[model samples]
Target: MIEDMLRTPAAVQDAERHTAHNYHPLPVVISSAEGAWVTDVDGRRYLDCLAGYSALNFGHRHPALIAAAHAQLDKLTLTSRAFIHDQFADFCRALAALCGKELVLPMNTGAEAVETGIKVARKWGYQVKGVPAGQATIVVAEGNFHGRTTTIVSFSTDDDARADFGPYTPGFKIVPYGDLTALAEAVDETTVAVLLEPIQGEQGVVVPPAGYLPGVRQLCTERNVLFIADEIQSGLGRTGATFACELEGVVPDMYLLGKALGGGIVPVSAVAADADVLGVLRPGQHGSTFGGNPLACAVATEVVRLLATGEFQRRSTELGERLHAGLHALIGKGLVAVRGRGLWAGLDIDPALMSGREACERLMERGVLAKDTHGSTIRLAPPLTITAEEIDHAVAQLAAVLAG
Candidate 1:
């Protein structure tokens, strides 16, 4: 009877009945996951091509991260950021070092991190940059998916994310994605920051022009505006680089990092910046109760250490080249086009082919689990720890679906 409770479809039905209908998830229910593979309750195994939206960059239940979580659990878990714990200082310090910055403000999820960044940018605008309080604006790119919070959603260019959500938060300006002149023209005296995804993941893993980031960095510097890179989806080794901005030898003033920061075990995210900019906050200005809990700190610490080795980045780079080549090889033959960087890709299907959702359902029927984004785009972002053999297997499954 207890085993019956473990049935995936039953659990899924219970969830649908109990939870909100915000997400239209796949039918398959993952019972157990490891590395790049997840097993359903029915004992069917599938390669997790999506990698939990790049949160599992270290892979599911990574041994080092899990051990860190277990060890922390035995000691202490949460202190509510009331007085602070032994792990907070070290965690913040590690994140600061990784970000190549002098300060960090920890948060729980990607949305929360984005919110925190927005607040900081606003404050910096008013207090530091001396913009009119309410007139302080943040420039955001169109087609950006920063997070799901109300304030975060206010600036979204997507109608689905914006419609029925207003009256929207004010002080946001939108411009076309990847347009340097548009971004430059949009910045003004009241503008505090220009936030962008170094590589848009949710919006079909959209890669910007080669010089976009570097150009943005230059523009922000010349205009005395902060260049905020929302690395929430594209950072932490997901793009085969430390940060996608690194591809152009540019470093943004502020980094909104999440997803893989907690090593797929817990929700841990943070905003990192240099001292003068982040030093805008004083005591009691902003805080999160569970921002730097011991458990999240421990796991995230392991995540940072793993990233320092460059192993995952190397793996993603090697596998990504093969993947992109394989996918583009199918272009015009099956796939309309392939767009993305590293292991994350966006496959635009031919008009005659099925929609991305339909293709996902078909892939589910096979042994590979991929999630679709826009109507025609199927996103592929497997774990950095996945083997070449698993890569081949996933490609074969995807190619078969394309052929048929």
Candidate 2:
């Protein structure tokens, strides 16, 4: 008891003393992780249900990714886009092929990719679509969580993310999510792009109504507005497919990809689009220093190869059914609603029973690590590599926590 008291507090206090309170992270301080599990500083093991917000879709320290990072570290790390590295072409070509796009502009984070997409769309609006200069408006949906950039958060519905961050950037139209008619009404001659998450991940894994994505695709096609799908959190096997748009048989004009693209190793993000759209940017218009570094490219290339096998997607589909079935059984017991696809889920815990934060804290005490969203919603995005037994274990823990 004395040792337990000493360890957790000291670690927590040291962390708090050094870091800014930008995030109210759970009390557990993870020391190491492997596959679907992580070990805290106290040496207690916990099943990682959040998977770094789907950034670790390949799981912690995957062998192929680690090997790639190590090999590249031994050879070369960065050349800063000024000169090309050997790992650059293959990574770009493979990722572009995976995305089925003519070009890929690599960046360092999801927000950068989103920013890149906006720039490219605006340029395309002026150069190709013949919209007036500096008047290109992009239509976005409500409850969107694209990124926390000054420009990206300009349209945020969340007060916490948006409040006091302005003078906000302009030229974005916000409409209700999953409302096709509102989206249609919002887009006009000045609209350059319609930016959306194919499945809203940060917004409690909310899936859009049936045919909404397809309808959006059709509308974008008919209206000459570029459809930019921000797949940073919903892509790369998180939704049981290469991209969530595939679930609706809809293909957007551009894919903003990140998270798992880095193989849980480094920050890697990119915007994938065909020639006509991406070609609008001349050489110096947009770029990043560490965007396509040698180390990042090597790790992400292996990540692409792993996805090419389709094994992870298959795993997510099969085990996701098992996961949903287990969570669905607990609906009336403690959970109120469950929504998601593949191995991703958002469980709305009965507010009367407990807040999502309290439930997650209890689950942490019982050897499971998950993240809470909003007031009563908790997101579960276990690695695609997780086993059925692990899924059952996590659900059992949830049940135990709720029963108390």
After superposition of all CA atoms, the RMSD between model 2 and the true structure is 0.8
User: Which model scores highest in TM-score?
Assistant: 2
Q: Tens digit of lDDT per residue, candidate 1, span 1-404?
A: 85566577787898899998887899888789988899987888988998989999878899999999999999999999778789988888888998999999889999998898888899998889899868999999989999887898899887877789988888899999999999999999999999999988888988988888889999999999999999988999888898988877999999999999989988999999998888999889999998989999988988999998999889888999988888888887779889888888999888588899989988998989888887978999999988888888888888899889
Best by lDDT: 2
Q: Could you tell me how far off, in angstroms, the CA of residue 376 lies in candidate 2 after the best superposition?
A: 0.4
- Return the lDDT, model 1, position 206: 89
Clashes of each: 0, 0
- Give the Cα-based TM-score of candidate 2 against the true structure: 0.99
TM-scores, each model vs. reference: 0.97, 0.99
lDDT tens digits by residue: candidate 2, 337-374? 99999999999999999999999999999999999989
Query: What pairs collide in candidate 1?
Result: none
| lDDT value for model 1 | 0.89
